[model samples]
Target: MALCTPLTNACKRATASVPSASATSVLKPCSSRWRRGNATVAPPVTQDATSSKGPTAMVFMNMGGPSTTDEVGDFLSRLFADADLIPLGRLQSYVGPLIARRRTPKIQKQYAEIGGGSPIRKWSEYQAAQMCMILDKTSPETAPHKPYVAFRYADPLTEEMYGKLIEDGFGAGKGGRAVAFTQYPQYSCSTTGSSLNELWKWRNRLEGKRATGEVDPEGSIKWSVIDRWPIHSGLVEASAQNIEKTLATYPKGRRDNVVLLFSAHSLPMSVVNRGDPYPAEVAATVYAVMQRLGMKHQYRLVWQSQVGPQPWLGAQTSDTVESLIKKGQTDLILIPIAFTSDHIETLYELDKEIIGEAEQEGVRRVESLNGNPVFIKALADIAKAHLQSGSACSPQMTLRCPGCVSERCLAQKEFFAGQAKHLSAFSQ
Candidate 1:
C-alpha cells in the first residue's frame, strides 16, 4: 500500500472548494511525513475503476493505535488534539497538546506493558478482510465488496483512506457509493462523531457531482453510513455466546456462583453532562447481552479507561471489584462491553491491571474477550446489514438511537442526513 500525506493547498481546502485542477492533479509526489520513503510521484487514477454491477467500497472506521513504541507519543497527541475527542473549544488547541505531553509517560508505560504497542490495526485489518469475504458470499448482488479501513488517530487515517478510495474512482461513478461503517458498537459524539466528522470533511472536499452545482451527478459518490447498532441481534448474540464460553473458565458445578462484570470505556462526566449518550448506549448493550445469556448469575455494568482527576461514569470497574470482593464475592469475569478488540484497555487495563487489583483483594479470575469469532462475525453481520440497506445511522436507522435523551444527540440529528439520502435497499 502506498502511503501518502497532504502537501498541497488543495489538501488544506474544505470539501466544496471548486478547484481549477482536478483532484488527481492536486495530489502530487508523496511526502516523507507519511513514512520513511523517497519522494515518488503517484500515478494518476483512471476514470474507469468503477463498474455498475460491482460493489462500492466498504470502509470500516475505528480509533487506531501506534504500530510500535516509537509512534506512541504521536498517536496520543493526535488522539488528544482531536476536537471530537476532548472538545475543549478554543482551549483544546493548548489543552489537548498539554494533556498528550503530560500523559505520554504513563500512557507509554501502559502500552509497554501490553507488548509495547497496540494490536488494534492488525485486528481491524483481519476484521475488514473477513467482512468482505462474508459479504461476498452472503449477498452476491453486492459482489466485489472492497474493504478499507480509516483509523481516526493513527496510520491509515480517514483522509488517507478517503484519498485512496477517491483515486480508485469510488463514490464518483455509476453505482459508485462509499459506506462509512463504524466499528464502534455504540455511538457517542466522542467516538463515532469524530470518525464521521472526519469522513464528511473529506467528502466535502470531494463533493461528488454536486460540486459543480449540478444535479446529483452520474458518477458522484453517493454516501451512506452505519453509525451505531448496540442492540443488533447478531451483536448481542455474539457477546452472550462468548460470555457463555467464558463461564466455563470457572468450576463446572459453581458456574452460577461466578459474577459477570460487563465493562465499558469511561468518558468524563463533563462529556456526559454535555449530553453524550455513551453511558446509556453502553447499558443497552449490557442489557441485551444479559437477556440473551439468561443466566441466573448476577451481572453489573462498570466503566473503565478513566484518566485525569476529573470524575467519570461509575461505578468504576476497580471500585466495583473491590466492593464485590468485600461482600465475599471473589469470583469475577470482566467482559469489555464497548470494545471490539483487545487493545491496551482490554489487555492491560481490564485483564492485567484490574485483575491484578482484584486478585489482591482475593478475587479468583478476570477474563476478557479477545477478538472472539462470534463477535467478529457479529460485526461483519452489522456491516452486511447496512451494506444490504445502506442506512444505519444515529438519529433513525435500524436501531433505537431515536430514543436518545442526550441533548447533544438530539441536536446532532441533522448531521446524519447524508446517511438517509443514499440508503441502499437490500439486494436479493
Candidate 2:
C-alpha cells in the first residue's frame, strides 16, 4: 500500500487557486469619500471562452517508431542520444545503433506479420480522434474548441509540429487555447517526459525567435498545458474489461488458472534512482485494474523491451515466465499496460521473445489484450475529464511548481537546459 498522489488529484489542487484580480473593478463604492478618493479596485479575472469550449489541443505524446527498416538506424541514434531516454554516456553512440541494426531483421519480420508497419502511430491517431469524438459528445462546447493532434518523439511531428500548430492558429497568442497531453494508460519518463521536453523546447524556440527569422515568427502563443494523466480509474476499468473480453475467448475453466502478467516498458535503474515514478505508476495501474475486476488470482508485474547491458527494471518478462513455469503455472495472459496501442515492443518483444520463452517452458495457452474497444473508450473518458477540468495530466506538474523543493526539481531544470543546448547545437 505505498501511497502516491494520483494525477487527477494533483491537477485539481494546481488549478484550484484563486483567479488573479484585474485592474478594473466591477464594484463602485457609493460613499462620497470613496467616490472622491482615487483608490482603484481590482476587477475579476475572466475565464477564456475556449476554456469553456473544451481542450483546444489534445496532443498525443508517444515514443514514435521507425516506419521503414532504413529509418531504424537514425531512430535508434536519436533515442540513444536522448539523455532522458537512455541515461548512458557516449556508449549509446555505438551500442544504440549496433543493437538497432542487429535487431532490424527480426523487427522487420514482426512488422511484416503485423501488416508491414508499426501500428503505434496510426493507432495513436485513431485514439486521439476517438477521444475527441467522445469529448465532443460528452462535452460538446469544449470538444469543438479542443481538436486532436499527434506528435512523435522520433518522427515527422517533431518539434516542428509546435510551430505548425501556432501557424494554424491553434496556439496561445492567436487565441487563448487549451492543450492536453494524451499519453494513454500511464506515463513514463522515457516516453511522456521526453515528449513534453520536446514541446517545451519547441515553445522556448518559438518564443526566442519571435522577432528573428531563425524560426516561425508567429504571434506570441501562451500555452496552458495539461500533461501526463498517469493512471485513470476509468482507464483501469476499461483495461479490466479488455482483459475480461480476451479471457472470455479462451475455453471455460482455464480462466482462474491463467496467470495475469502485466507488462510495461523497462527503463534503466538510473531513471528510478533519479526519482522517476514510472515503475510505481505502472504498478498502481495494474493494482487498480485487478481491484476493479475483483480478482483473487495472483498477478505479476514484469518489465519488457529491455536493451543494453545496464541494469533495467525487473522482474524481466522472460524470467517471470520461467519462474512461473517452475511453479506449474501453465496458462498466461499478458496485458501490456505500458502501451495503449500495438507497436514494435508489443508486436516484436512480448509476442516474440516472451511468447517463445513461454512455449519453451511448456506453457500451453498465451492470451493477450490488444488495443481493443474498451481500452479506447477508457482513453476517451480520461481525455474528456481532462478537457472539462482544464488541468495538466502529470501529477505534481514536474515543471516548476510554486513552493515545492527537491533535488529532483533542480535536476529536471538542469536537464531542461541541457536539452535546449543540445537542440540548439543540432539546429546550428
Candidate 3:
C-alpha cells in the first residue's frame, strides 16, 4: 500500500502541541489522567480545532488479558460470567465464579511465566495510536482521530471506555462520531459479537436508556462499526509478509517444505453449531494469506486454547504440530491467524506450552503483528474506507446467525444498524 502524504496542518498542530515525554508515558491510556466525576460537565467535542470535520473517536475493541498476576482472578471471573462467551444458561451466575476461583492459580502461573503479565494492553495502545496517526493524514475529513481501546474482561472495560469518551466529550447530550473497530479482523459472536454487545450495554446505561432495538435519540453518540475485514488486502499482505520473514529463518533447503500451521483460538463446538461465522472467517483469512503468498507451502488452519471438556474446533494446533513431527516433518511455522497482538494465547499457550513441549528445534512461530507498520497502515485503510462509506455498520452486521436465539444479538444489531439514519449528519 502506498503511504499517505505528510500529516495535514491539523495533525501537525495536534502533534506539535503534545508535551515532550517518554514513549512509554505517551503511549499510556489517558483514562487515568481524566477521571469521570459526579458532574457530567465536559469540554464538548462538537468541533475540533484541528479540522472542521474532526474529533472522531477510533475505539479499538478486543478481549483483554490481565495486566498482572494479581488481576487473574477478576479477569477469569468476568470472562466466565460473560454469557456470550461461556453460556452456562441458568447456572451462569452460580457456576461462573466457581470456575474462575478454581482456575485462578493455574492461570496466574501462566501469567507469571510470560513476564508476569499479558503484553496485550501495551500492544493494543501502540497499535491504536499508530493507526490513528495514519488516519489523521489519510482521512483528514475525519481528522483529529482520537484513539481509545475498550477491552472486554479487563481494565479499561466497556463502561470505562465509554466514560472516558464522555469525559473527553464524545457523548453526553452532545453528538460526536465514534467507530467501534474490532481488533479481531474476523467477526465472531464469541469475540467481536460479545464486545459489541457489551458496548451496546454500556451505551445504554451511561447515556440515556433507549428501546432495545431503537436508534440513538438526538444529541447522542453517532456510532458506526468497522465490524469485520476478514479478507482485506492489507491484512493478507501483512500476514504473508510476516510468514515470509519467518520462513527465511529456516535453512534454504528446508524452507520450501516447512508446514505453515495457521492457528486461532478454538471456539466451542456449540458456538460453531449455532452458525457462528468465526470458523469460516478464520479460514478465509488463512486462505487469503496463502493466496497472497502464491500458495508457496503446505498449510492447514488449526484451532487452539480449548477450555472445559466440551469438544471444540479442530484439528487442534498442538496435535497438528506433534503429528507433523511424528511424520518426520520437523520444520513448521505456526501463525496466529485470528488475533492481531500477542497475549496468553500466543505468548504462553503457543510458545511455552506448544513449542516448549514439542521439544523440536525446527518448530517455530511467526511474530505477532504488534507495532507492525504494514498492519497499522492496513488498520488506517480499513477505518478510512468505513468512515468514507458512511455506513452505520457492515450490511452483514445487521444479520443474525441462522441458529441465533439471543435477544441481545437481535437488539444490539438493530441499535447499531439503526445509526444509519444519523451517520449522514456526521459525514456532512
Best by lDDT: 3
Query: Model 1, range 286-358, lDDT digits (tens) per residue?
Result: 9988888775788899877666567777888878987888888887877778877656666666556667656
Model 1: what TM-score? Answer: 0.79
Error of model 3, residue 11, in angstroms: 37
Model 3: lowest-lDDT 10 consecutive positions: 1-10
Write one digit per residue (lDDT tens) for candidate 2, span 1-428: 00000000000001112211111111222222211111233221123354344335566666766556556556655665566676666686776566656655655555555455554555555556655666556766553433434454345565655644544444333333435464644555566656666666655555434323333223333344444444576567667877787677667887666788887777777776666767877888888888887876678898776666778788887778878777888777777786665566666566655665566433322222234566657666765565455333343454552332445444444533333222221110
Cα error of candidate 3 at position 234, Å = 1.2
When sorted by lDDT, best at the front, the candidate numbers are 3, 1, 2
Q: Which of 1 and 3 is ahead in lDDT?
A: 3
Worst 10 residues of 2 by lDDT: 2-11
Of the candidates shown, which would achieve the greatest TM-score relative to the real structure?
A: 3
Of the pair 2 and 3, which is ahead by lDDT? 3
Structural similarity to truth (TM-score) of each candidate = 0.79, 0.73, 0.89
Ranking by TM-score: 3, 1, 2
Q: Residue-wise lDDT of candidate 3 within 350-416, one digit each (tens)?
A: 7877888888888888888876789989999999999888899999888789999999899999989
